[model samples]
Target: MPEPEKSVRRQEEVLRSVNPVLRGWAAYFRYGASKRTFSYLGWYGWWRLLLWIRYRHPHLAWKQLRRRYYGADRITEGGVVLYNPAKMRVQRYTFRGAQISTPYNIDEVDPDGARFRRTNHDDVAFVGQVSEYLA
Candidate 1:
């Protein structure tokens, strides 16, 4: 119960920080029960805003979308956005096909030779320096 509340609060904070319009829409949509009987204008408007953002602001929308791929071959210059910090890992790949040669964490593997940088945010980490090991 508390976890869901925390998640909602975090989402509200991010949305408010990014755009106050979204915060207002979220508030109205969540509490517009009285207005829901006549028309779902608030609900419809929120979905439209989300779709608009998805197409017009892909980079910003990426935070809402998620993808998972194993190994270094899939690693991009943008690096990996680890939503779950518990899965922090260093990936080493072969130069030929860019396939992973090894996958390890700080505890299991020494990062001296990996050449990576980990940037932590509220609940996610943007790991850069992928080319060093993938090269």
Candidate 2:
């Protein structure tokens, strides 16, 4: 989606334009249940790139395009690596449960008063409980 007119550019140039956006998207969504979404994004990116390559080299076959762009385990062209969203590791936030300190019970939770105050303590506790139960 980032490089709308990359059909005239080289593979490395297109990758340079697209990788940053892909990296940012993956980073923003990594801290949630986003594995499936990441996989779909990766597949969609691959398909779009392949289509671009086909447009660029209409005379070449799919095998030639694959050999030119894809490496053994990753997509690489002109020494530039293509960012794959599926490679991003999903990290779900851990629920501290009762260990989490709230503004009302900050003194009880942390005797040393090192923790910050949480304004919406009830909402935070409910979400944490639900996440913990689901996990």
Which residue runs does candidate 1 get wrong by more than 4 Å? 1-34, 60-135
lDDT tens per residue, model 2, 1-135: 586764457788998998999999999999999999998888888878888888877999988888876642366677778788899999999986546666666656654454444445568776786789999
Q: State the displacement of the C-alpha of residue 55, model 1, in Å, after optimal TM-score superposition.
A: 0.8
Per-candidate TM-scores read 0.20, 0.66
lDDT of 1 by residue, 25-122 (tens): 44444433333421344344344445544565467545443232232222122432212211223233335321222433434434444454233453
Q: Over all chains combined, what TM-score does candidate 1 have? A: 0.20
lDDT of 1 at 73: 26
lDDT of each: 0.37, 0.79
